[model samples]
Target: MPVRYLIVDDEEPGRINLRLALADYPDWQLVAECDGNAAARAALARHDVDVIFLDVQMPGETGLVLARELACLCEPPLIVFVTAFSAHAVDAFEVHALDYLLKPLDDTRLAHAVERAAAMLRQRQREAYGAALRDYAVAGAAPYPERIGVRSVGRIEQVVVDEILWMEAAGNYVELHLPARTVLHRITLNRLEALLDPARFLRVHRGAIVRRDQIASLATGGEGSHRLALRCGGVVPVSGSYLAALKAAMAF
Candidate 1:
């Protein structure tokens, strides 16, 4: 019943210090260490980690952004914020972080946070955390992600959600269609759909998801088949099952 955890910090020294401190806890095991939010997400995709010691600040995307994405996940890991700035405390707690620890870590505070995390996990209180995350989003404390990270050529690329006109299934991956180009994102259409804001995106077919604003017109063909023309001059099919939902979303 060991607690598997990942440490996410931009600074190597900070990661090292936290690793050394966590070594004192016999029941805790270090699953992996990541330099930033993107690496952490990649690690999470590969491993079933129980907790994440997340640093609030990073170069490209902040830890809070990652936390917001994680909350949308089916089963998110427990988050413990570790940072130098105390100013992010309120935001951290709003995301239902297990604990927030300031940098230049204090032994007593670290131990307490570790204990609290272990207790919560043992009690199987993750559902409560998930509920709080939903409530946080509903309360407008956190919004659906504006950008999504996709691993590409040994680096993570940030895809602006608003720029995507539609999404098509590409084997195990999803192709994000933009106005001028298409970006391949390594995620399933269903999973990616779950992460997006439902109010703005709609599933027109089993293999297609289109932004609401991009829909120009819906065309019907022989045998009940239908297709939608996008404002960007792109077309996507519409399955009969989703037609009603699409019509409702389009207010037609």
Candidate 2:
């Protein structure tokens, strides 16, 4: 059987370009194309796809968020993140993603990613599975915080993870929030999430992640959407798709 595949990116042109690039790969069937994380999530729940060409940055839920969820499945498809951002490469490999493809969708690169996906599907090593679990545990460590190195003026500074109130993506850099300070780092929010404790730090929006203790309350607005009000009085909008997870986290 042809390797069933799903292409997920918010950009229509990017998706179309990827399809065109994969035209020669007859062994890889283009099973679905999803514009956003919600659509991709729905498709994954219903399909038995072999691989996914995912874009890391999207409007609502990011590819990383979807990837983490997929990792919980019995047989998660091989993930190849198709992203314009290169800063996330380290984090991608940490989560055991099959490969990473830079955007603008190079034909050669796409073909290589597809080939890697094929190899992963065939072998499906238990070591890779164990590595993925180890990555998740290391990434999700909480309560006792670790020191994250950050570059300050002239030199690097070690910041305690627990002091973080929230993080916001600002173009190529991520803004780290704390009780009395806010600093900018060269890393993207996606990369930062992979290093933070998921139980204590929840991504409430596409561009933001908040520490659970820092969240003052969650307010529901029109159309069933929610907004996270932080102890600092900063508010971040939460999409409907992630509302369930947030509500569950806040419960008890």
Candidate 3:
């Protein structure tokens, strides 16, 4: 059987271009094309694709978010992130994505990714699977809530995980929101999500995660999108990519 592949990108042109490039591979089957994370999730749930060509930046749910979920699947497809952002290469490798392709993707790179996917699919070892995940966990360095250390001015301050209200990404640094005050921490949202307990801190957006108890309300935005109104009077826009999980988390 040919290797089944799924192409996921928010841009119609990118998707079409990838499809056109892949047309040269007689052994590859274009199983599906998803415009965003929601469609990709639905297709993954219903199909038996062997690999995915995923775009990192989208309007709502990021390619990374979908990759995390796919990692939990019984037989997850090989992930080759297709994105314009080269800055996330380290993060992508850390997440154990098969390959990272830049925008205006080249046929040579696509072929290389396909070849890597083939090699990975043929591997018989399961031990290496957990190793990649372990590396990824460390690569995406998220602070452990039970024991989090923050830097306030020139002093190293420690804050318990449970006391956190929410976190926001500010360039290379993160703003840690607490009940009494907000503190600045040097961490990426991707790394932070890996450390925090998912049950306690729900990622409502690409750059924000709120403690479940800190959410004030979920207000509907125009179209099918939603926004999370925090207890601190801050609103976090929920992407359509993550709306399903967010709704399930809130039992809405």
Superposed by TM-score, candidate 1 places the C-alpha of residue 65 at a distance from the truth, in angstroms, of 1.0
On the 0 to 100 scale, the lDDT of residue 136 in model 2 is 41
Give one digit per residue, the lDDT tens place, for model 3 in 45-130.
88888778999899878887887776655456667788777554544452342357888788787887777666656663223443
Write one digit per residue (lDDT tens) for candidate 2, span 145-245.
Answer: 26554533222344667788888999867888877888886566777787677878888788989888876788878878788888887889888777787
Highest-scoring model, lDDT: 1
TM-score of 2: 0.51
Which 10-residue span in candidate 1 carries the lowest summed lDDT? 88-97
lDDT of 1 at 150: 53
Q: After superposition, how far is residue 44 of candidate 2 from its true place, in Å?
A: 1.7
Output the lDDT of residue 109, model 3. 76
Backbone clash count, each prediction separately: 0, 0, 2
**Cα-lDDT of candidate 1:** 0.77
TM-scores, one per candidate: 0.53, 0.51, 0.52
Query: Which of candidates 1 and 2 is the stronger one according to TM-score?
Result: 1
